[model samples]
Target: MVAAAILASAPATAALSADGGVAQPARPFQFTVIGHPFRATSDENLLRRSITEANQDKPAFIVATGIKAQTEACSDRLYAQRRDILDGSPRPLVLLPAGSDWAGCRNSAGRSNAIERLNRVREVFYPDNQSLGVRRITLTRLSANVKFRSYAENAYWEQGGVLFATLNIPDNNNHYLPEAGRNSEYEDRLVANRAWLHRLFLMAQRRNMEGLVLFTDGDIKAHVDEGFSLLSGFSAKQDGYAAVRKQVRAFAEKYQGKVLLVDSQGEPKATPAITWRGNLGRLGVGGEWETVRVQPGTASLFSLKDADSP
Candidate 1:
């Protein structure tokens, strides 16, 4: 476990600010990545314990890729419960809503509209400009000039000499549905996402950032072994996955800096699927990129060190 090294060398209290805020440490700082709770029975206790443990660890911040419930009906109560649990975390939490949270509800037995569910997600999860959790951090989202100004879920921030960005790339083939307006929505979000990627790379290049991290709820690099990727293509009108991979890869190559891709998946651990963890970071660096399987009561710890350090 990478966290073991951090625990052995660094004091647990190193990330706690004197004023009860998150400490703004120098480069080589550590943080936590939490995927989502399993889609089993509706058990909030397990999630509460995970938050408690993460708070005890005291990382600089925490990021939850997305949450999923396997129940037949997508209930608003479930979403609200998940949001409340996230807000209870003692550290700052960055959440990225994914397909399971909204997309799959479209045309389901419950007959929920995808767009409406997405709107509800934003309304409930992103009620404020600041992030969830007790420790709130202001985010830089797409301003009024952007087409999807209501998408306050996308955000970017700088930390410890690195540029961290979260995009609203849900796993449902990016909403490339055949229905009317679905294609337009997908296209618009795609354009916005592309622009976001370009801007992130530009910021890194201009600001001389040491590394860049782009995380989302969707697994852009899904392969044949992953079952979720199979379902994504059914809703795609244009080849969104290919475009995203190409653009992000090109940027990483051009930047010639360490880049990390952190995402969450809905598949349970018992299923035989592609391994979530992989080595896609700067070839020689220790912690470049990997997927964290964050279940109830468990979180992954990692540090962002200068590319050439260690």
Candidate 2:
């Protein structure tokens, strides 16, 4: 297992202002986001290639949005292999779990083993308060809170006057289950997520951060106001992301800084794009990877470019 570092050796991107606010960097800083590097069971080579490409650009940090493909088995051996792969990054690398990481897991009896698998994922990927890589950065995990001790994967950090966080919203409909007594996992996690969002927004507001960026596997933007259907009666499928979306919208409305939501499970696009609605922006990254530049004090606080661009 990798050990935690008190602070990263990377150059300082942000500093504390005289007034105790977070000061912007002298210039814009860039970071890369790798969307589902392991797109297939045989994509280990692809994952390594993606990391090498991102490393060549020397971004402040790298965020890989998923560990394995849905078809991959959710087993300890596979998880260990992926963890080793992620640990090879020379730059600080933050990981966000995808639905395939846990949602469809099953036990020997063929029963849903999602919770057990999710915990195993947490144990492997988020055992400490630092990112995986040769150069590690400190992070604040939700598990620091005694009440939400199990959600170590929900982590947040700051860089260049921006607050970045990862939420456990998976691509499999937030892992919602329609069966009456089968939604305990989803319901419990929903509560934890709401509290985590509240804490993140409040921290950004207090620190006077320039912008807030969120990373997750699911496209929360696609589920805004996605209401329930009456046709299916009590068993009707509900929008698992509704509560979190509502919270994000409310927080963004009250926040003075820009809000960017990034996810990996969006439709594959020829070019990565970000759609804006007032201060709120939604970026659905597809293809291999996307790099976003954060320019503090600019009208458009953030800008996106394909990682493959020259």
Candidate 3:
């Protein structure tokens, strides 16, 4: 097992305040890439081995993408993680939502039929969204068991130099979007989400941090137009996907920074898919999630290895 200790510690990035105040930034640490841990059920021991193996080889902070459950048992897996893995570790566990989490609960209609499941998740992980940051939870081994902040489509918060903002976007399956016959509830949700995202990004710019992280449960490739790229025609379009994509792109370009777009609803890789995680906007991803090394204000969409200090 290659589960070596910490390689190095450095500042990821930093920013400034409008009033000439120096700003805080993200902590510098190696980020480990782990695909959806939620799918590895009925085989806890095997799953644990696989997870530890991946971690030992990569030695990254846990990025549990698309780790959802078809049944309520999912929450148990999440809770058990604390005892099974994260108890004494200082490394953080970061996550984005995936359709199998709740969107897959829908029947043929593609509606969120997983209300019970959703409620259970919310209860277990987030009886309070204010602390959860959408579905992205950050658990540090500090006091109070670490209340990881949660944001809507766009909400921003800072931790050990790193700032995290999340987007609770509608599922690519259009499950969250209102149907032709529905009431205006979704409309209200849309307006709220839009305003929230804008505010979060703008704040990051104002603080002169590094860049903002925009996390969603769905795949960014899914937001692209049909036949967006030839290699994997699996990318498709949905109702709000286009608009959100445009906004993210514009924000990054305007600030000359980067946006960290995460695909929470990842399927699996025939081979090792997430071995190399880096800036992927041009590859159809918006910004390099890994680049905002020290802070969001000075957000550079480049490689950390390209960083000057370390």
What are the TM-scores, per candidate, against the unseen true structure?
0.71, 0.86, 0.57
Best prediction by TM-score: 2
> How big is the positional error of residue 206 in model 2, measured in Å on the Cα after superposition?
1.6
Q: Which digits, one per residue and each the tens of the lDDT, describe model 2 over residues 110-211? A: 998999999999999999999999999999999999999999999999887689999999977798886789999999999999999999999888876778
The best candidate in terms of lDDT: 2
- Give lDDT: candidate 3, residue 118: 44
- Cα TM-score of candidate 2: 0.86
| Ranked candidates (lDDT, high to low) | 2, 1, 3
> What is the lDDT of every predicted structure here?
0.60, 0.79, 0.41
Q: After superposition, how far is residue 20 of candidate 1 from its true place, in Å?
A: 33
lDDT of 3 at 189: 40
Better candidate number, 1 or 3, judged by lDDT? 1
List, residue by residue over 1-310, the lDDT tens digit for candidate 1.
Answer: 2231221122234355689887553444556666555434346565576567656656667777555554434568878878888898888988877666777775545575767777788888876668898988887876434566767777887776567788888766666675665476677777888888898899987765555667776667632232333344453335457567667767866773456676665344322122222313411111111222211111223333232147
Model 1 ranges off by over 4 Å: 1-25, 39-42, 106-112, 143-146, 178-182, 222-239, 266-310
Consecutive 10-residue window with the lowest summed lDDT within model 1: 282-291
